[model samples]
Target: MNDMAYGALLPETPREFGFFVDGAWRAGHDWFTRTSPSHDIPVTRIARCTTDDLDAAVAAARRAFENRSWAGLPGAERAGILLRTAEGLRRRRDEIAYWEVLENGKPLTQARGEIDHCIACFEVAAGAARLMHGDSFNNLGDSLLGLTLREPIGVVGLITPWNFPFLILCERVPFILASGCTLVVKPAEVTSATTLILADILAEAGLPGGVYNVVTGAGRTIGQALADHPDVDMLSFTGSTAVGRSCVHASADSNLKKLGLELGGKNPIVVFADANLHDAADAVAFGIGFNTGQCCVSSSRLIVERSVAREFETILADKMAKIRVGDPFDPQTQIGAITTQAQNDTIMGYIAQGQKEGAKLLFGGRALDLGRGHFIQPTLFSDLTPSMAVGREEIFGPVLSSFHFDTTEQAIALANDTVYGLAASLWTRDIDRALTVTRRVRAGRFWVNTIMAGGPETPIGGFKQSGWGRESGLLGVEEYTQVKSVHIETGGRTHWIAS
Candidate 1:
């Protein structure tokens, strides 16, 4: 392979761009230029989907489902197709990685790792198809037989975010297809190229036309139409809490379809006095700064024990200072450019809010100078309180807010005080203390002595306002299927008495 292709394996770029719909490449109504945040240059121009385009895509998905091209396929056959797609993704890992880096503005190394994770998601979903078995209860009461079966929910509308576009799409689509459902995916306009390219890979892997569709456009237009489309059986979305709420409201106008939303989070990392300071610092850094803190499950709030708070802040600031920030294509860069200029402005606004809230800015508080790219310094704040907007809200940027707590009880209280309960991390050596905090923290995923460590085996979702339903693992497969109970009377008949 040439160096470009080889680097593609490590996260580079695709040779060309196109949108995949009904297993074919079709030009959209208009094109929108995607600019590289690291270089401030046009990466590629993608199809700017219109409302009519979304209607067409959803109609195609509905036809594919009604015709049973996917839903009627045998589980084993569907499983084989998904497995083949996973294999195809593995073979072109470098290409996918490169496309991800170019489109998503994540560091090359992180983009490559995300590509591997995406492959793993498909593989796991493929295997999960066989495990989608139901229960058969014979002879429940001498003459009655009962059986429970699972079937796919037709025509899933998958709306993914820009931060981890490929990973999020894999998390939703593979499982939906594995459960024998067709999908109409609308990736974020700013980062739709990688997903559209994957559509080509899936088509090559033998996914039937209309079984999977990609519609690219801004959320206000195409996204809203998809959510409100009466034909879509379910909607799976991952983005900001405000938009998630809008989706929920819009769904109410349609069929009130099954919804899965992974929304915003101001996830907390509570470090106790007994915690390993060095390890805590490193884990906290990864939690908040990974993906430039654009992740929904980011541990943005640090509730540290007052006894070790000062020292932990020092360690964290020193660590933040060392993160290499630059171009997304640079292998040595740890933090890549922000995804867009608007996102950069949003993050900077939050940094200013942190200062206005009286939180002490410890270190790294300004946007970086990486040519004309959208780069922000990894920021850390001290003297943060639970009542402050910086501590309560989801910034979705590379900003960390540290709150001091005097006791473990106080730490747990502060951690659970937010409207979001997506994920949280606890750093302590005591096993019993970890268990105690785990029980009290109202999050879907909890980490002890670690932060954001998992593979496809772990199920991911949120609690309360973090949104409903689960994704990944066997539970993820269940999300796409509906359960029905069949009851039969062999020797007896039931009668109702008149009142």
Candidate 2:
């Protein structure tokens, strides 16, 4: 890779932003500027909020939930607001994508697709608001009636990570609102712009003041505050597994608020000998290359049948080599800069460790310099054992480790060997083999012949350490709600005491 000129996509000046609270933008005690990860230029200046600010936001959400300003609305009205917000997102998709690319270091094309996915999330949530229902027992005695009611759990706290900032936020927001819960969101400080901008969209769409709030700052302060706040009824966090454990501890120490977490993953991509080599190779390339491999659900492990292992590795390496890695603004660039310097160093460290641990470097192991900003070539390692650190840990970069299995049983066992079970992909032309592997693999989301497939229509979560609860689809709306069983006498009241 050679030096590439920074294009006009770089903002000449940093855009100033304020935290949203009670339907208004408020200044913090301090402020900080965020530099674009790809261009290495100041992109946005954000308020540096503190725990007190988080408290204010939580209080506002609590008030809104108690007053029913948003919760009191009819299902049709809430759905209408969500639909309008979706339209607003469509209107500003380009601008949002630009900000996403600059701050997150993902390609412009991928960011645009994320915006579209966000829109679909809102749309699906709107339908769920209308269609979501509880159950009634009609078989009870004539004088007795039994019904189960699904009600909003109350104030919800949402903590989102830097990777897929707006996408993850939208995946939960509309659904939380649809469940009639007020929420306070704490987006990753590095990528808070889009989440803050969403405040305006929701307000313009007729959402009540205090119904939704955002506090921007470091996670240790604000995020911990959300977890410990007694008034918060639920907390949904998306980030690393270590932090997810901290969240669990905080919840237990505090109110034990309902927790919804989408945590870390060392997902696997298994390819059988009977699979289409071309399609499997392509999907494997996309699985590790997408988002520069920063995604939690990214398939970092390649488990292929030993018979086709050499051939498949060759095809996959060729595909990875041809992927364009350059400026995020460049439409032709398939892979962009690493999101942060720390992540870049981490990936490089893993590359070194793989070699030191005796795994053969099949393809890339060097970093690329494109003028400025951090970038690494798509990496692949072969002869990887299940015990290798690179094979077990989540490197969270454009790195793929390969393992060979002689039989389907070995492939399935290798895939399930990891503690993290976020997702897995199986490539096989044989339906029986696909179904068998899919059943045995201990992953939450499984794809046959594809990787990272489907949309907001289906539910997604982890199996073991991947995190608790689902985030999308009809189940998404229900996650923020609690169930209450109600019993009534239709004709006469039955007294336990003799009267």
Candidate 3:
């Protein structure tokens, strides 16, 4: 890593890479460049693949799946490869983190933390490979036996977003492979380096040829191709609800493939009057400030008890103001650059709209020109109505909108008011209140007394328009599998016609 002033890091030169297909690097007729969001310099040149290239990658995945080169391997053998991949990731932790920072524009420390979480995904998936099992029925008499088998769902198409690219990929890849499925990935064009690097690491870890392939290009061309490809047996997508809906349409228009989507969120964090205001305030700040509030599970909406709303808002504002917004290379920087120019503009638009809607700007709302690179100071808006654009839509930036509730029931209502149900969190010392809110919040994942807590051991997905199916944990592995029932007879069956 090359060092700069203020403890920032940069690459000596822009790294060049090709698409990975059929266990080999393939060049494209055209190329696209990804500039570092935090430095405004070209950091990587990725192959610009077309629909034909997508077909090739999908064909390779289909071939690999049909041939069963990886699927035929014993569970222990598959687990061995996943473990090796985990080890390889561990070895290249820092290098990968550097690339992640350059491509995704997240703080170095936060990127490193995501790498650790990714490593755990692989490790857990390795264990799951050996432990995942189908069901057998012994209830039938000696004359007959029944069984239910879980088999890989052929070729899988994975489309990941730019935010948390590597983490989202790792969250699905190992588990899909564990279930004996082959995959072709379409990573977000701006953040393709880590996904391609992961392909190399998997190959180094002895993953079979064509078992894991990566294709890069614009989402409209290559990404939609993956979703529409009939050979793809399943499509797992993580992005905005609009795109996720399109993926569903592509599936319905094509093969009606199994879909797993983790889309947008207007997640809420409710704090009761009796709750620890200090702790709740810290969590509220961290929840929205983390990843610059570009998280699907970010607690963007804060619904505090009316009595303590003013006090809690003050504490949260102080914490949000203290968040270090600086270079991605700065280990102490809690907030980094916006991942893309368009997203920055979108966030700014939301900030403007919030003001237009009469929401009070409690803290930072202006864009920061940090010498070079797109940066936004951590922002908070109070006195927000649920009808405001910032309050309703997924801003996906370092912005928090505040709301107040006079009762627990109102808090629950405010939390469940969004079209999304990806995640929700609440702070309360009373067990009854916590239990009630957790059960009635209408989110797939709920956190009580904490925020953004959990591991790969738990499943993650959404309800309603937030999308369907789950990822991670044992269910993550099963998500890529299809179940079939089998029946066997111990005694010879008598023919009805003959009788």
Candidate 4:
């Protein structure tokens, strides 16, 4: 995973890799192969870990935590290792970015940008570690003093999704490490390639044995095992809301492990008549088109002021027409392959549902045969009502449902109509409207004039079924720690002690 070795993988064809556990790379009981979504051919054969592997990885993490090998470290010491991890990621940025193209099919340029963001995530989490402090108060009697301490929450289990494998791991793992919690990671089986590389990156950066471990396999197996293990103190997962519900249930059925789920989002992008039409259109395109709109925060809903709806649709269609959809290895490919054939089918079903519901098809809306992998064109639906299945459900693809509103209140209503509340972007030149609209939007991240804004410094999660708990920033670090209170008697020992 070192930068010098990056060149070796760029001509990157299918390669076989093993899981990393207890600071050692090991093969699984069986194996699973993942095909390159762009090439529609096998590109990776990964270890399919069984229950025994899960036990071993989690046991290692438990030993590390209980031994205080990592949890007992001072904030500065933990921060140092986290910083090293960040540096390690920076060094291997190129190779890892390219691997993402092969494994996840994000465009090379976007993958590179995501790698940069990953580095920032570690750096920011490192900063948050230094800021992990508790408060002191003396509201009691003069002889009494109160203090609080933030302690690492013991071993944590992480299950990340494939849509942005590197991105989600960077978002979760750094904070967990910075909080001094040992972890057992179960990245999505379809895209475990870069995560395996990350295992090497972390170990090379000097993370102690058992302090960080990775297991690859089906989520129902390794992921469920991690969730059910009594030793795991917390579980952080990123995926669909249905799967998120299952995570919650597993936690409840097990030791009631603390759960942090960053789940599904049918996010909305609102445009006002006063906004710059072209700029709004471009932002909408980027929002839905990024990662082929596989992101939880993808703006699948476009609610525009009626006066600007027709014009905005025209501009967005033009932008979609200009997008390049082809091989992921090509740096110019704006939209690469969908993560799997099943996912492509699901998206197509949603498009057909839109058509059946009488929504107008403004632009693209069909599966493309690029002669290799799962590819879908950027799609748009017009005159969609809030109640349409396409507008209400999480398609998790490059599909946008278009709606219109005559007033700001109506626009807000349209945006808030979904079950999801992960993110929303508002476009308006009016400062009052921008502030008001963004504030009123029920989303974890609210963007004004700009869509998909924010970085590692900002916290992201969701409201309602989008899932709970924040990731990134100081809030993220807090999710991995438990607070304990201590009181001391400074004046004199009370007679009640003897009594």
Candidate 5:
């Protein structure tokens, strides 16, 4: 079969344009168009969820939780459903990829990879369901029995970002469902097609009514509703640090829901003079430029040892020049368009700010000449200090700020100076150096000689203001559950009579 024939089987357009509630699709009065960031064309018109829609989705999730259709299902049965969902995702991988590319302005190749990762997430969560076992003790005392069990934390509210709609949804929703909790997911307004498509796939995989729902709208309206919903027992959010703070405050003021947030990061890549400069430069490029630098964990800061700083900058600039930035569907495109116009402006503003702060713009420092779409050049800035705004803040765009350090201690200090500690990478062949750097870094996930090399098996989260709690692995499943202890008094009931 030809490539076009294969592509035809995939969903190029979002056929269903409504919120998924109570196991089916339903249209709303208001709808909004989702534009392709790469082409600046309307990809699909999705339902703009109102407060009523949010209430309905939340109510459905609450019903699913209270009715125990999901919570009371057998572990193996729930696992089977999840496994089927994963299989369905695999079968529709190409279509899901298309939707992701159209809605999010990521390259089609990256979108396909994201779809595969989403499937893996579901499969891992399915397997995790069987492994969610509790402990028991029979000889705690004479004729006494003790038991401990983990139960689902009721309804879950998942709010995902635009950059990685499908991947983030799978990361949170699968674990929530595996833990026997129903969910109401709110995808970012700019990128909701892939998420809505996944909701359909889940329904096709035999998820019951109210088990999973999707609401689409602005964060202020729909997302805030979910965050403040009293029935939502737990809330998992992936977004900016400012927005995450709002979620925390909302949860505290509302039902005090269990909150898990993966916020923004100005992640650093520290390169020592003795490090593998070739590998380090490649990793830095991928970490910062991939997804057009829209990822919260994107390594926006590069801290290089002064000895190798000049040579490394030359190599990095040469490499950044070669990266193709254009249509996301193109096979050769490495850096696609920025996800949104606001993000584009934000990125360019940072580039301008870097220039104003006296950082040398070694390469791109402006928007691309690409027609119509929100495209920005992959920017690299050198001669940066730790105090500069561009160096200190999370620029969520394809912009890298390089800072030179004289010693390993300074590198460590510079890397750990940011308030956000999501993830960081170190490039060094010396085992002692890698160990020392990894130990000193305050981030939740650290890499040595490699970056972004984990999947469902590895837990991903943040430290400090980067956010709280993990999102993958067994720890992710545990995060969605509550522990309960049971104790029984048998035989001798010697109470404290006089005490």
Candidate 6:
């Protein structure tokens, strides 16, 4: 009934954490159990869906799209469903948030915030359904009436990641629905429960059967099917750049499906000497440390002016040390356990690489065991060169690598050095400098004097190898629909081909 009771009221392992297909919950022929990141206990025995299962889910989505049962619903009706879905998520927020903490190994506070954002994604997308529009073209000439029709791209396959699973789904699925497309979702195996719960809530909210299907398993089998399925029109994936490349290739080999990928980031945050030192320090700490630095837009690289580098690093290290790394369920905890042993290894490996590359380890590289959970102290590195692995690569963990820059040009150069252009931040008192730096940075999302500042309304994605296609905003809504241009002879046809 209340907040604290939710941890008990919510199931640690649900009786049925199965696939949702054709408006019903079903299990796969095979299954695998997930041990919690918060604590190494059984979270759920998730369905180990093969390509065959993926095929069935895709078929369901295809049928729904072809039948126009869900996809053909009027925008207003669709909007109503989306709005109701948002409300449904609201009702189950605490439960879902708890699960996020358990599975993701993020603090409960951060999990709650993610839940709020997820709710916002659906609510904003409800409005997007009505706002999806095409343009009228009169410049083509008065004799011809020309316009474009924006229509859904048919069945879409969604492959989401473990980090921010609920938020990514909300970012993707709602917009896909808003554009009148049916979905076949493959959530990350580590965090499949929340999505299953979401499917159930959608059913309760009266979502049409077969409109939103789920197939859970390893990304290799399930996600590969989605990418390569001939029936799937689009593949929206959020994961690492390497996996995203695989999705592209798979799509090319099979359906040649449209792709919406929100991939990995080695994002940069620059703090000029003119900026407020404390404020800059705060942003830097939170940017790299929030969600345990397991975000596409995590400001993992901080480029500070050489004049203030020492002071900033001291303040930043102090803030990082203050971050409480403990049980995710504890509301007072700032940093939770590493999501999985594999991720913990990856983080520690990166730390080792940073050391190997001669980056100065300023603070925290020790791993701790919080009961059975895999825990690590927040890691920090200074005197990092552009060529260093720590500075260039994306280590999706609670790690921060700092660099010193003497001039704006050097700062911009350092920020833009990486192949990934997912997101970046700049902290400066000068608005002019902020604007200039923002324009120069190649990332899709840029935060001036702020870090990881965006909501459901703000578009988020990457440029280079980080991945493509934006999420949220009107642009995000537009990404799900294809445009068809039409021309009609109103007065008479004027041929430009011949006289």
Q: How close is candidate 4 to the true structure, as a TM-score?
A: 0.96
Give the TM-score of each candidate: 0.95, 0.98, 0.98, 0.96, 0.96, 0.95
Model 4: runs farther than 4 Å from truth? 1-13, 497-499
All candidates: CA RMSD (Å): 2.9, 2.1, 1.3, 2.8, 2.6, 2.7
Model 1's alpha-carbon lDDT is 0.86
Q: Tens digit of lDDT per residue, candidate 1, span 88-161?
A: 88888877776677777898889878878888888888889878988889759878889999989888999999
Rank ordering of all candidates by TM-score, starting from the highest: 3, 2, 4, 5, 6, 1
Model 5 Cα lDDT, one tens digit per residue, 1-499: 2123113332355354788998888887888887777665567888898889889988999998999998898888898999999999989998888878877888989988888888899899988988997788887877788989999999899999998988898888888898999999999988888888888888889899999999999999999999999989999999999999999899889989999999999999999989878888988989888999998888899999998899999999888888888777778888888888888888888888889999998999878877657788888998886678988988899899999999889989999998999999999888998999999999999988898888997799999999999988888998999999988878977778855
Deviation from native of the Cα of residue 195 in model 6, angstroms: 0.7
List candidate 3 segments past 4 Å from native: 1-9
Better model by TM-score, 1 or 2?
2
Q: What does candidate 4's lDDT look like per residue over 275-317, in tens digits?
A: 9899999999989999999999999999999997898899999
Off by over 4 Å in 2: 1-7
TM-score of 5: 0.96
- Model 5: pairs clashing at backbone N, Cα or C within 3 Å: none
lDDT value, candidate 3, whole model: 0.91
Q: Which residue runs of candidate 5 sit more than 4 Å off their true CA positions?
A: 1-16, 495-499
Task: For candidate 6, write residues 408-451 as lDDT tens digits.
Answer: 88889989999899989999999889989999999998988777
Q: State the lDDT at 171 in candidate 6.
A: 86
| Least accurate 10 contiguous residues by lDDT in model 3 | 1-10
For the record, the alpha-carbon RMSD of candidate 3 to the native fold, in angstroms, is 1.3
CA displacement after TM-score superposition, residue 231 of candidate 1 (Å): 0.5
Among residues 3 or more apart in sequence or in different chains, the pairs in candidate 1 whose N, CA or C atoms overlap within 3 Å are: 8-94, 9-94, 11-97, 11-98, 12-98
Q: Is candidate 1 or candidate 3 better by TM-score?
A: 3
Please report how far candidate 5 places residue 444 from its true position, in Å. 1.0
lDDT accuracy of residue 164 in candidate 1: 93
